[model samples]
Target: MSALDSWHPDSKDLANLAKERLSQKEAQYILDHCKECRECADKLFETIRSQPIVGERRLVKKQNWMRAATLTFFLAAAILATHWFLEDNSRSGQFAIEPKSLPDLSETIYAEEPSTWFEDAFTHAMVSPDGSKMLHVDSLGVSLVDLSSGEDLRAELLLDFDQVMAATFDGNGRIARFANRRRDMGWFLESGENLRSTAIPLDAVPVWAPGNRDVVWIRPPGNRIVLGEPPDDRWHNIGDRVLGLAWDPTGAAAYGLAMSENGSASVLRVRPLGGEVEIIREGLDASALPNGLAVAPDGQSLFISLATEDEPDADARHETRVNRDLDIYELEIKSGALRLISNIEGDDFWPWVAGDYLYWTHNEYDASVMLIPLGNPGAKPLFDVVGERDGRFATQLPRWNPSGELLAYTVGSWRLADWGLNLDTEVVAIGSDGDRGPPAALVTGYHADYTPSWSPDGRWLAYRSRRSPRPVPYYAGPDVTDDIFLRRADDPDAEEIRLTDFGWEVGDPNWSTDGSRLLFDSWDRVPGVSKPWVATIDPEHGDLLDVVPLKLPDEISGSVSGVYSPVSDDVLFIERLNPETQRLWVMLAAGEVEKVIDFTSYTRGGAAWTPDGESIVYSALVGEKMQLFLVPRVGGEPQQLTAEPVNVLHAQISPDGLWIAATRLSQKKEIRRLPLR
Candidate 1:
């Protein structure tokens, strides 16, 4: 279609415009029409999104380091997260970074990692109140170091204090750490030359008070305040998610913000002596995230940051979801008056109140701390972590010393190589036979792309991708979400067309034998339960008809992925008995339980049926490596495929047995530090 009939551009012409294949005159003519025609404008953008995003994606691997995919693509790799496996899931909590809200980092010096400076940095470092000493934990174990003289004062390797959640110094500069044990989690404090442990909840960071009473703290994964001291420890139900807690100057009571069941919060006052829980303010609109706290130096007001619930994102596929970032606010302690302090574009939380400035870290593509005039919105950035120049390093987790004299944070070389938890992943095609050689990148971009299922005829492919409008770094938040996308299986650099936008995690994508429908599992509307979802599509035009979960026989709750058999009417899937228990089961055509395979699988990219439907192929962690395993339809001991030391994820053999299209991960990481200023 040209400018003769309805003056609309077809998909072919739109592709040329997106790839800059059209001449200046021809392109200008189409642009002039698109400005007036809403349909054509939308088509042009859709075509652009379909093209291969080589600008920020890498298509190759290196023996050690990555070489850029495009000449202009500075970041070739970063992210490989065995570090976040299972317990440290990147998608466990819900947090989102709006792509529109993020600034393009290639043009700026933010989000890039300065891994070089932190190649061998310690994982945890805590500064004392006077800044005279610091408590650090490394492979050698927990040790106290004198920052000035560079002297190792003491070492506590047997204690295993590396994973301290929150450590605060008492008036005597003693550190309280979570004591990791088998039975329960507790806290241990350094009393004189001896270590004393308490039964207080490990997460509730105790504030050392007089009479050996450590009061004030909220329990994690819940909304309860742990008060009193040993023997008579009291757990008070706040009935709200506590955001920030700050102690008054007199230390008589602690003031904190606790978000309610709905999208509102209240300011609370807890007196340790009388166990009095008072609500200073209630029904204040806010988002239950980004915990923050700050008491003015003069003890006049309390500072906090919150995202109001009313400002939901319009373009979001998830309905009734707020997309606003956190902003700072000030509350007068005595008068109970609350006022907005800073309403910036990004997240501003965990405030620090100095003499004339209020310091808080701003969350965006760039990691920065801002210092604004006392209770003022107008502020200037005091320190900025710029690492994109080399794309090898990143710095974050900045904390102020007790005296507010120095800022302490860590720089990491721990680039997940774009293949870890929260990291970017690309759909790569590998040959089943070793003769077919190395894998080739397809549908490359700066988002998490995985779970590829080739069409029956091998003309098209269906996969799940967390493709966002924003440029995702090594770690995209859980709320970023995975959507279904279709691409040409033969064409490695083909345009990718999105199918579904449910705004939650999608998994185990499978293309039907007839290539008419795409089936995958989702945890969208149903949080814990994993239901198989199906969508009909047009292979040529990539038109999505509708998406709905397939109702199978029996209660197959919390299923992993369901794969259709080529020969019979059987579906293979993994059943989740609990968080750690995964059992393999097959359902026949009439919804009959075939056989429960004893093989336990914690598979990723999902299991695939062989071309003949006789054997099942899946990836499993064997000796710390994700290796491919083959199991028979009848069940028994599964056969192992490859034993390569590297990660081999999402492996599936082609129908012709010529190629094995699978995914793998490579990564590097370390830690270091930077000055506050």
Candidate 2:
């Protein structure tokens, strides 16, 4: 390199070699060829002086060539040094790109190590099968962890990704499955197969079958129980609009839960793959259970938990109807008999089977995870918790290991636990060891993070984040929008990528049938002024593509709502009808627009398509309260998804298309989930 720049590696090596091979004087002579070339320089100068005798053009050309070569060497050296330094800075926790957004979410989430806010706000997490691997899906991507060792397994499985919504473990837990904004499902194993994915049809969500025999996935006609069969075109709809399916190795028959327009919950028993729809229990008043049916091993009994109106709350912030109570019932599928189990007087939901015991989480006065013994009429407290009765943290979901030996749950922002009042939500694990360890902080930061979904592989997790404590404005109006984030399941390192930063506010992001993309609605503005824009997002990179424009602005300002098309790359959007009512419209990837069937009168705010992509599911305000509706995507009269009008909103379809998980309004704004079946 020239004197203007640093030394070149080749030059340094040459000098060192000379020093090692020659005597000091000789080495100096060899290395300092330029400095010692005064005679040669003089000869060159004399030649240049005689350039007039030679040619001006020749002399100028030679000088230019020498200068060009020297400059090139120096420039190359500078570039190499800079690249090396940058790489080192990134590894040392110093390099960062000043993102486009003001008050970048990325900076705040990864601002510190073992960050208090991000750590505690873990809304979702996926634990691997052997219980060794764990994955945390956040803005950054999917974080893998070795749970047995409590160490980060990989820095990231996906890069620059956001909206990791759901994750699970396969049979052995060696492979982890995930679903993101795209509603696509992905599987990853430790071997060579990475990013092995089976796209859940845009119409249905796929859930793992018992013992990994097949996956209970959704399609147009009904629910499909797909075996461990490699993904192909084979999908069977066992029934018309089959909502929920549960398998108990102890039971001779599998049970399904369904809801009808008559405000009745029906329990159906059938064989594993394809069988007769035998109604075990019918016409049970109250809607479907939040958590699906739980069957005992002996097949003699079944437990179904459902929600109902309790009493009025005078202290409620909103001027609305009174609260309701949730009840758990034990029924004899064969004898057509039933008896009440809990009826916990509050919001009861999330039922799971653990050995001979039945477990569930409910919100009576507050959130609590309760347990009941199938063999014993009365059982002492297996576990109980009190959580925030307001905000996203108010309604909570508890998770249980497949073995049922370990029970895991979350405490919301306002939760009052034995360990003081939790200002942020915390994820805690309880082993059968009777030893309840300290709460493991999941997500933390300036926002309220909740609604965690675990992947099948147990190697990754997905969740959503909400900006909490209200905004303390530094600017006049908000410039950037709220998005999703991610973290490592084992390590303290967390990174957040932007999912939505458009001018409009986006909410209720759902993963596509596959894990690669996310579906969400971009609300134009506040209610009464804006339309919902249906948008598709890249979960790994937070890049959003406007799939459906609600109004189809002539040049600049249209709106849309809903998410991905039930079957194709197309999207479902709600178009405004002269600002009075909203209608369903389908926007294909090719930019083709077609109006579908009407959902209901003045349908706004919330909408979704059934798992099979054949039916359009949505929530509409009927009279005073909002009711659920399911209509054919091709065009048809809308069918009610919910019977009673209890102000239901923010509803989402599970991968299996068996249940509708949503936040329902009861007493204290409880979160309730029910079977679509």
Candidate 3:
């Protein structure tokens, strides 16, 4: 072969060179040779055309061969620039591009169609009080689905909020109360209506009364109960340190779970319209954490959802741990006597009473709607609602219409472990100085992209993405198996190239300093067993070069975390010795491993090495909250960086050392209503 002909660049390398990611000299040499070589020029043109193009471009006149070739090169460069612009603009605003709202599939699917219920991991559902319509909420916005029409009842009232926390329909189903983390708003369910919102104090839980016209919510700091109306209404305090609330059927009285200074809890009843508060039951030894409450139809008893203490080895890094023992109890209003009602194996809460039945949600690996006759507490659930796929399905917030003919609840494939991955998460870029301009989304669609690692040159990003068809099971924990994807840091619209797809759990991807190898941890052939490995790949053709398994200590078997050092040929990783303890280890590129930092407490992965590789930044659970800490690579006392209440899941130091890009867990769940048979 001729000397010039032999120097052919692969598709990936050629695209990088076209985008100017290569050194100036390297890029110029390729361009110089392509100008005179027809074969190389044709190859380059085909590569550029194969990539995802944003918009259609008219071809230049081919009458002049040289001019056409030059125009082609410039056109490719322009396409890359356009992709970056669109990506940057989509994520710059208060919210990501208004998610293309989900369409009502009920219209297309017949009622008798088996397995017709649409399933989503991030959506919530709740039936209206009257049961004629249903309210569906998700990360994109709030949707009111009509049962009879199988369409959105109020399309104009579909409030597209970024993160919706709680949503409820009033007794008349005319007004709805919805709260995200920042604020709570009242939505009139009529057509073409706007939202009426009010600022909620911190740590306060907002609840709607039976009338739906009045809202009873707790005020933060002191936990004072307040009742107010919509549109800048006044709030009146009724009780103090209330942990939970429930309104009576008559709407004249409301009951609450109150906590004492010494950690004891009690139930109190009060009138929202300025009346004396009565202690229904005091000195109850129940745990301070109460999830939900509901008053008996006859006003003789109260149903409360309480959680037992979590196991010592439970991983708190997740939004909600698996197998969190929760149950519902019945308390006699007059005698203060309590009895367990439902004790299924799962995280069960959100109890709702309708007629003679008590309904609640059971959340294990999947979520299901469970119900039992109040008169027969010892009997099993009359029926459990689930999706047809047999995958990880969840059904929560069960509500019955006034007639009780149709049951409505929200169903999805996501469980508690999938919370942070599915909703309100975006790979945001901030300056090293913490000047967060407009955060850009790393990827868009139904799938989630997380744990982003910048390439050594800062021109590309490698992250783990959950785009597979199979749903992650609940017992598997939050560490899900995903395919590794790579995309240009600047080109948002460019198609992401998939690297690894063995169907094994993979995460914490770290790029080598030379940008030719990727270091990550993956589960072995056995379930629940994980090991660290390094893979050399050709980014130019998106081909895997070789896989090198690191020699791990015998004690380290269940799960391990690894990252490539930003400046050296070494890899830093954390290996769990047991459920409660883990140790930091370092390994050379050749597979030799050495223990570095011994950690007795809970430490999560996603640790980042400092630019100089002398220190590491990671998150550790300190006194119930996950905080950022900086530890020396050689091992010493770690320095705490942030002490806020927010939980930092992943932190990455910028290439320029000006910003720390982190994925913060702010709000986790939202409520919605779906129809059940």
* Per-prediction TM-score: 0.43, 0.32, 0.39
The 10-residue segment with the lowest total lDDT in model 1: 74-83
Q: What CA RMSD would candidate 3 show?
A: 27.8
**How does each model score on lDDT?**
0.51, 0.42, 0.51
Give the residue spans of candidate 3 off by over 4 A: 1-429, 468-481, 553-559, 600-605, 646-649, 663-677
Model 2 lDDT per residue over 1-677, tens place: 54423322243433332223233454334334422233332332233234332222223354354443332332223222223333343322111111111110111111111111122221223443333444544324456665445466553444322433444444334444454425444443233454545655544534454455555554444544433335653444444345556665532445666544322456776555455557776665433222346665455666665442222121221111123344666666657676544443343444444332344444323333333222233333232332332222443334332233333344442221101112233455544433344555555544334444332223333444544233311111123244444333444455554444443345444444454555554544444434444345544544445456444433213344446654676677765554335677776677677777543333244566665777766666666555567777777777665544234444445434544434343323222222211
A best-first ranking of the candidates according to their TM-score comes to 1, 3, 2
Q: Distance (Å) between predicted and true CA of 520, model 2?
A: 20
Question: Could you tell me the C-alpha RMSD of candidate 1 in Å?
Answer: 21.3
**Which candidate number maximizes TM-score?**
1
Worst 10 residues of 2 by lDDT: 101-110
Name the TM-score of candidate 2: 0.32
TM match of model 1 to true structure: 0.43
Give me the displacement of residue 193 in model 1, in angstroms.
Answer: 20
